[model samples]
Target: MAECAFDFEVLALDGTPLPLSQWRGKVLLVVNVASKCGFTPQYAGLEALWRAYGPRGLVVLGFPCDQFGHQEPGDADEIRTFCTLHYDVTFPLAAKVEVNGKGAHPLWIWLKRQKGGVLGIDAIKWNFTKFLIGRDGQVLQRHAPTDRPESLARDIEAALA
Candidate 1:
């Protein structure tokens, strides 16, 4: 049986396994992101958060998902280039993965179980859905697709403390 967020490994954009264990004991902002979604602009805010809090033990992990509206249609390289050129995003990004359904990533499945969405819907509602994971590798909070990255600072601060 799985234990915590560290139990899973997601593929990096380069297709190598990236283990969550590597970031154990750090506050994590895990976001299911998309390139063409209306919230795509949030990438700038996310990068800002990473730049501001990364030095203080915060890690922002972006998981590209194309499930909703086929928003993230690019391959890994395309996604990488877009993020770098547009948002100047410096955070680590995972390869595209489904955020819902049977093919949903294990980490996401476990996360929904930990903190159900609004109205108790565990499945992701749309792109840009975010989850905050504490240093202990457990889900700290589940954020709506509409929630801005900057709005999460207070909760992240409490978790870091």
Candidate 2:
């Protein structure tokens, strides 16, 4: 695995290669998202956070995943349309990715290793799992799916500081 979060690359919603290094020195709020899950509404809150902190070197990245209940089984275009119509998301979004098992994305695997789940499990438990990344690309904190995006302002502020 790569040494830091910046050492990974994930496909953008447009299917272009997007490298994490491009956001180096910026605080990142990385989330595994879904289109149809109960926590899908968090997208709005995430967008709010992005708008609130983006000017201060904060980038909110959403990665669509279908591992949980097939919630995000849409292609890039479908996902894009859904997000636009439903949440009006403007933050960056990675293409669909697997967040568990052998098919898990490299960045995800590294993230889990940096901060495990409840009971010390590395495997993701559900969608909307959040990771706060420092400006140096180190994993700073892991938040559960139930953690609202609005609740992270202080954490983001601290990271930005």
Clashing pairs in 2: none
Error of 1 at 35 (Å): 0.8
Per-candidate local distance difference test: 0.92, 0.95
Residue-level lDDT tens digits of model 1 in 1-161: 67888888999987999999999899999999888999999999899999989999899999999999899999999999999999998999999999899999888899999999878789999998899999999998999989999999899889888
Q: Ten consecutive residues with minimal summed lDDT in candidate 1?
A: 1-10
lDDT of 2 at 10: 96
lDDT of 2 by residue, 1-161 (tens): 58889999999999999999999999999999999999999999999999989999999999999999999989999999999999999999998999999999889989999999889888889999999999999999999999999988899999999
Candidate whose lDDT is highest: 2
* Candidate 2 structure, TM-score to reference: 0.98
Q: What TM-score, over all chains together, does every model reach?
A: 0.98, 0.98
